[model samples]
Target: MAGTNLKCRECATTYELEPRYVCEQCFGPLEVAYDHSRFVDDVGALRRRIQGGPQNIWRYGDFLPLDGPPGPALRSASRVGLPAGCTPLLRADRLAERVGLGEVWVKNDAHNPTHSFKDRVVAVASQRARELGFDTLACASTGNLANAVAAQAAALGLPSYVFIPSDLEEQKILATGVYGTNLVKVRGNYDDVNRLCTELSGEREGWAFVNVNMRPYYAEGSKTLSYEIAEQLGWATPDRVVAPIASGSLFTKIAKGFEEWLELGLIEGSVPTMNGAQAVGCSPVAQAFDAGADVCRPVKPDTIAKSLAIGNPADGPYALELARRTGGAIDAVDDDEIRAGIRLLAETTGIFTETAGGVTTATLAKLAARGDIGADEKVVIVITGDGLKTLDAVRDTFESYEIEPRLEAFEAAVEQGVHV
Candidate 1:
């Protein structure tokens, strides 16, 4: 009653907190359900504790499901967790103007240690895995999660196995392997890898598949993003938040974070509407939204936004319900628009993001153009990863001019309208 428990999102069946992510009754996804009565009646003390704690997600430890004090793991002669959150929330006036909005902000999560928001989830998963007596950790990743899990496992000195699609970005593959974890490349897509991991999870004992067995704890990590955003925005919630959808967990977690804040009296006003973006080539959730269907039909992914290419999203139905309940819309854009989105964000905010971020940015523009998002509303676009990881997506989208190191040659190139 004091701590947390696993609650079925569908049947409301509650179970004792354990290394489980799915309910036995309805086979629904399990979520961490905290007893709000444990929180102190004094909001000021809570606020001060959060503000004065570590400069990371641990500052909000009370909100997370962990044993004892929720701190980072002391491994590799250093700390391994607690540094994955507290990313900057930049006031993107330039981006807002370009998107025809009165105000905009970018929750730049690329600043995480692993250069993606996955670090937050992996940090918690690694810690929880160790606490649950797991000496090895594993997951089925697209790209960013592989980099994050491998890096975090290395830092924690735990043997890790990451299953990824064979055709993931070279940068992601190299980065993940550099962590020295066992990297498995499947010939099939992410869904196939995920299925294999699920099978492996049932076969292997003491191996905590972060996104499988320890998913409830792992997913709780994403709530820190919403907490950080509200704290950075003067303890207020934004009117809208647009995030790219892969499995749709992050999107729903953001909404849940805001609701928790309101329940705890940590923030005022209603929760923000949740907008989701996806690449057209792999947009099951967005397609479901467009067709007014509650179920998402899986599609074969063929987009440069590989990070957001989970065709069979586990949280697709919940994400769709949240979007509709909040009066928000889900949309998809083609590869060209995704590339243009990356350029537009870079030109305006100087933040180069991965193709998933590009999808979110471009979708924001599309929503703005259609007057779906009001021009006078305040919006925050979530940039989930750094552009450096997916450089191939933009390799042919821009060009640089070569000139001799002479003043005349430079002048000639400038006269020819060469990009500076």
Candidate 2:
């Protein structure tokens, strides 16, 4: 309700709040613009208001792009669907020591309703769709978004369709299909699936494509992660943030969230040093960043991190700008390092993450090894999804000894150094 208009990120041209993601003039991406002047008068009151609201993302409804006032009524209606956000911000002492960092925290977003951060975006987008009088919910996903969209649509009792690459992980496919959505598996990569959805969105009226037509509002959902992180940290910002990049929306929006709060005098710090992580197999953003280029060159993905396999990220240019401006860098890691990253995080923090998080953890370790992060910097690595979604990534990573149910056999196995 507080959103004023949809403004072009490049041209600054504005349009009435509609389900539009591209500017008609420059064809640049569009995003939700808000009027925060009302909350500037009393910072304490605003903080109290947010703290006293719902325990989910709706608590920051003043910052979201909804068309209605955020309160008990709105939250009650939203509760019928999967309420997202309010995930834990855990301090990982062992993880920090293992990575050679002085202080490290884990924003474990895998604890969301769909076991991924995609639930945050879909919650906002689907609510906006209902407000706009859309009949059906739809999206094009690599994996996690499919599960989020399907589950959210089912909760809202709406007919939904989810399109994903046919080669996506079977665990993610099964998780999505269980929600009773019309799952369309196309024989292509994530880019191909996205292109097809863009075309379909144009032809299908009354169907709200969450990530296509409704993207401007959808992307705003990621800002809640920043809000939560800041709120959880006693209204302060971390020294650095290490997060994965897919469409680059989540990476850039997290910075935007911190910026918005800092500008409003709500949080006490500049935007964190924003380090982005990527799988080397599909890391166009990292390549562009490393080469000092302003534009990203698309590539065919060949990584196990399917959730982050978007080669031509829509926000690639913006992600590069943020990483450089904040004295941060976007780095890539190989598949071997990614698997090792998963194991490292699990062994240290007891949090098993999907490949996207693995990419982030690996990049953090790489940064630590290369002396990119200072010893005293308070770093937060965002784990976006649960490991169960991409179970194959850890299939052969660790040894599992199968011996008869006997103490002698177990002792012998331990003697052979199998247990450790």
Residue-level lDDT of model 2, residues 254-287, one tens digit each, is 9999999999999898889999999999999999
TM-score of each: 0.97, 0.97
What is the Cα-based TM-score of model 2?
Answer: 0.97
Please, what are the lDDT tens digits per residue for candidate 1 over residues 154-231? 777778999999999999999999989999999999999999999999999999999999999989989999999999
Q: In candidate 2, which residue pairs get closer than 3 Å at backbone N, Cα or C atoms, i.e. clash?
A: 1-66
Q: Pick the candidate with the highest TM-score.
A: 2
- Give the Å shift of residue 135 in candidate 2: 1.2
lDDT of each model, Cα atoms only? 0.89, 0.94
Q: RMSD to the native, candidate 2?
A: 1.5
Deviation from truth (RMSD, Å), model 1: 1.8
